[model samples]
Structure formats: structure tokens, C-alpha cells
Target: MRNPLDENKLEGHLRSVAAAGCQITLQDLEGYRPQTQPSTTSLEYESQYKLLVQRLVRSFSLEQLTQVLELYHLQPPPKPTKRKCARSIVEQEWNWPSLADVRRKKIDSEFSSQTFPLARHVSFLLLGKDGSQLRQLSLRHNVHVSFSDRPLSLKAEGLSGSLRLLEQDVKDFMAGITQETFALPVKRTISLASIQHISRTSGAFLETVDSQKLRIFYNKSHPHTLVLAKELIMQGLCQVTNLYI
Candidate 1:
């Protein structure tokens, strides 16, 4: 016997079930057995199926929709687009808190260079004291103290190399010291000829040099070593562009 119901009629049945709030399950539908009419084309069957789905959606409540979607493992509809807020638009326009601004804020801390005094850019090293093995003196220029195996080494990392003298020199200077402290004045004046000679010999371009102030830090009352350092300064052995104690 030929099946009498077509795809359209089956769609109508589905709409009626949904409108009456009559719940239907997959098992019930499978048992009911939808029958296509003998005259129904393949395209017509597909169209009717789509219409059935659309009508069912329009008639079902939120709860029914949720249950149906869950039963079928279907994805929910996409969320609606959100409207732009005034503050967000303003922030986009201003573009504050840039990378540089953030970095500056972070670096501008209590221990920043601006808060601390300016020190000379020099190397720091730890070596032995006693002034023995003078070759061990080859250290980073910024080192003021000795950190070595020698127990006699003084902790003078805070002092400058200009203030340091050889052990023999210190001994000789100490012999004549009656006062507590001694000061040696160095002349700031440098002749143009001397500058040219230094530039040629040391391969230092004088034109790019900024400040040339001679600075010396040494032990107080060490007159012998002080005079020796002063003579070296006079002879242009080392150029103190900027000296800081």
C-alpha cells in the first residue's frame, strides 16, 4: 500500500504539536514514521523539512528550545553585537599610558639616578691590600677596596684610584706628616699645545671632548704621593675630563 501523507502534511503535523505545547521526543517521531507522498519531488521534501523546522522554532518556548537543542547537540545562536561606550571611545582617541610613559613612571623610583648623586663612570674591582704585588693593582678603575685572599687588605672600595699610593710611597709620605690631612692643589689650565699632543698620542679626538676637569682623591697627609700624583697630572699622563669624589 502507498503512503498517503506527504512532506508538507508532516510539516503541518509538527507545527500543530509545537503550538499545542505537546512535547515530542526522537523515539516518538521515529515510531510515528513520516511517509512522503508518491508525487513529492526530492526538492519539495527538502523545502518542507526546512519550513517545518522554522515553524517549530517560532512556536516553541525558551525551555523547549533549550531542551530540543541539547537533545540534538546543536550550537546556540551567536550573541548580539554590543554598543560602544563613550569612555572607551575617548580612551581610544587619547591613547594615554603609552609604553614610554609607563617605562618612565616605573623607572622614576626612589633609587633612580635623578634621586642619587652623580658618580663617575668607572670600573670597580676587589683586590689585596698591603700594596704588595703591585701588579695585582690592575683592577677595575672604580674599585676602592680590596677583596682578596690577603687578610691585610683594607676595605677601600669607596675610595678613588687618585687617592691610592704604593706602600713605599705611603710609608715615605707618612714620615713627614705632622698634621692629620694634607691637600694638593692641581692647576685647571691646559695649554692648547698639550691638548693637541694628547689628542695625537692617545688617539683621543679633542673636538668631541666636553669637560676637562682634573679630580684627585687620596689619603690625607700623604704629601709624597700627593705631590707625585700632582706631577703626573701636570705632565698630562692622564686626562681627567670630569672628576667626582
Candidate 2:
């Protein structure tokens, strides 16, 4: 016959070991006998089980802990502290899975990426002369931007919705810079057809200055775009000048 008194003594020893943060294994309970009056013993064992669970949970990193809670479909704790999160998991009585399994099923649905092919000069302006603009853009949009000099492109990564908003903002910035005005003084008789062709090719609007000069207007909101527009207009003007010279 198994000794109930010996079982009690073993339970006490296990409790002390648990309290001291030592891992308790099923093998430790191998020789222990079950009690006939099992109610008290069952309750005590339940307490030890929970204690062991908490110790196991605390061993996880904060990120891992949160992931486990999410895998179990539990609401976030009100305080978001590690202790509270672990306690919430315990209180819910959910079965805990291994960390590898939790990570294997982790969802990354919210993340996305976008790329923009920016000209070298345009990239310089967008990122600013000192890179301050790039920093501010990242902070404002809660996204990360990476630059590639060979292709001269900007790649942004973040939540899907934020990426959409960032794309629109970048397009607007490019449009604004392309809208600068270029003035060309009338030295020789310039053909209206030539001016119209320049407008079509450069994607800029043309205005006559009291029949004395011609001005090209780009989208015009950005100072850098003004410089770029002037360069574009000058290239077209050179062709027009050659035609009449």
C-alpha cells in the first residue's frame, strides 16, 4: 500500500522547490501516491501548476510574451506590463504553445512596401541637402525609407494604409517642384508654333510677357522644382534658338 503521509511530504518538498524557482518535472511525482481524500491535495497541486506556468511565461521576451497572448486570442492587458500580460494569460486558462509555434503562425498582414524611381537631382531635393527632410518624412509617416544611389530610388516600408498616404505625398512633392517658371527674353522673332512644341515636350505652360518675352510655368510650388524647370526649358530654348539663329 502507498503511504499518503509520504505523498504529503513529497508535495511539500515540490512546493519548496517551486517557490525557489527550480523547475519541477513530471518525473519528480513518479513515486508519489494519490490521496483517497484528494480535494485538498488537488487544490494544492493546482496552485503549483499555475506557479510553474507563470515562471515559464516570465522566461519569454516581452515581444514573445505578447505574441503568445495574441496567439491565444486574449485581449491586451489594460496596463501592457509584462506581469499583467502574463497574469492575463494565466487567468484565461488558455493552453500555452511553444515559442516556435507561436512565431510560426505570427501574422504580418499590416506591413507593406513601396518604391519610387526618383531622379538624382530630385532625390537630393526630396531628401534635402542635409537629409533632414528624409528624417522628418519618416517620423511623420511612421515609415522607414531606404535610398539606392545606383538606381536613385526611394523605398518606403510600413503599414499598408500609411504607405498609400506616403505615396500620394511624394507624388505631390514632385509635382510641386516641377511647376517653376522660366523666363526667356525675346531677342529674335520666335515662332508661336515653336513655343507650343516646347510646351508639349517639356510639359510646361507658356505665357507671353507683353509680346516682349516668353515665360514657361511649371507646377511651381517648390524652389528646387523651379531650378529643374528652368533647366528643362533652357534645353528646349536652345533648340528654338538654333531654329531662328
Candidate 3:
């Protein structure tokens, strides 16, 4: 007998089940079953199955979506956009109830949490100017990291092993950063050029500010190189000042 539920009704029911955190079953998609008549091709059944899975996957949160992908041992794209990740998950041959059971067990049994106190500058660096680094770290570690601005800390939750590795990565990153700001005189073209040269030669990052100042971030281990860069900027500024006199 043909199931009474259409694709739209089945999708609505699945969305409610997901929101309610209920395990999904093939029975829940009774409406999506192929008709009993001879006109329904096997290819039609396959297409309907894929379409239902795609819609179901979209209802999951990004975190849950990733967990589902991981549960199936599916590799997401390098960029891991939500649409791409969902498409990858939909391609997997999943027994929904079994997959959900394994995902729940894995999360409950192996997960741990940690918080790191971050210096303002360290947080700034880890988050990147655009927050791309933080996103990358979250995906790479398979961990969720939340940052607090007032207290300036990061709270991370993931599998215990991944959490340990993420902690080490954060520490190693913090150890390497050395940030300094330089104030420039009104006529700073010469000083800016000198600073740029120092940045390229020493492999430092520079953040220019309103033509009046700049900030440089480099490894703290290279104190001597930083001293030389500062001297070069000052010397260039002095030369420019003398020329205008």
C-alpha cells in the first residue's frame, strides 16, 4: 500500500523530531515510501531517499551536523561550508537510529571541557582580525571554543584527546607572539617605508593606523631583530626631519 504522507509532511515531522532531540526512524518517513504500483522506478525511489536525507540533515545544528559526518567517517570539504557538509552527510549510507545511537554514545563518553585565560593580545591574535583563525581551529580540532570578552578567556569542549592537543596548540601560539606599537611623527612616509622593510625582512606582521602609527607582531624569541627594526625606523625618521629643516 502506498504511504499516506507526502514528502513535505514527512519533512515537517522530521524537523519536529530533530528539534525535540528524538531519534529518527525510517518509519517516520512512511509518507516518502515508493508507491506500490508498477509505474514507480527504482531510480525514483533512490531520488526520493536522497532528497529526504538532504532535508533531514539540514535541520541539524552545525555541531550536530559535523558529529553526524564524523559518525559515518565521512570527510567534509576542506572549507566545510554547511551546505557542503550536509551534502556529504546525505551521501552516506546511514541507518538513522544506529547512527544517532553511536553519535550520542561517543559524545557522552569521550567529551571533556577546558577553559584558558587569554591575554588581550593573545586573544586578538588567535581570533584573527576577521575570526577566520578561530573558525579554522574549531573545525580542525573538532571542538567548540567560545570566547568571553570581559574576562578574556576561551572555553573549549571536545573529546578529551582533542582537548589536550588544542591546549598545547594554544600555549605554543601564545609563547611566540610579541606585539609592539610605534608612534610616528606627522610626516611619517619615510618611517612607514622603513617599517615595511623591517616587516618583510624579519617576517613580522604590521597593522597600520591612520598614517600616524603602526603595530608590529612577531615572535618574542627574536628580540635582537625587533631592536634593529626599531632603530631603522627611528633613523629613517631622523633623516627625514633633517632634510626638511
Please name the candidate that would achieve the greatest TM-score relative to the true structure.
3
In order of listing, the candidates' clash counts read 8, 5, 0
lDDT for 73 (candidate 3): 67
Q: What is the TM-score (0 to 1) of candidate 2?
A: 0.32
Across 1-245, the per-residue lDDT of candidate 3 in tens digits comes to 53446556666765776788765443553334334422122335445545545665655555555665666567866887656666565445343223344445555558799899997657766776467778988998999999987788999999877887898889888888987887875565644556556665545555676577777776676566567657767777788788888
Reference-based lDDT, residue 22, model 3: 68
- TM-score for predicted model 1 compared with the true structure: 0.21
The reply for model 2, stretches above 4 Å from the true place, is: 1-109, 179-219, 222-245
For model 1, residues 48-167, the per-residue Cα lDDT tens digits are: 443433444544444455454445555444441111111111113222223333444444322311011111111111111233323344343233334332433333332322223333
> Which is superior by lDDT, 1 or 3?
3
C-alpha lDDT (0 to 100) for residue 208 of candidate 3: 73
Q: What is the alpha-carbon lDDT of model 2 when measured against the actual structure? A: 0.59
lDDT of 2 by residue, 1-245 (tens): 55758755765775565557564343443333132222222335455445545554445444544665666677887767766666666546333343333333332337889898996445755765357768888888899999987788999999876777788888887776643233464454346776555544444555555444665555455344345445655675677678877
Clash list (residue pairs), candidate 2: 177-225, 179-218, 179-219, 179-220, 180-220
Error of 1 at 5 (Å): 3.0
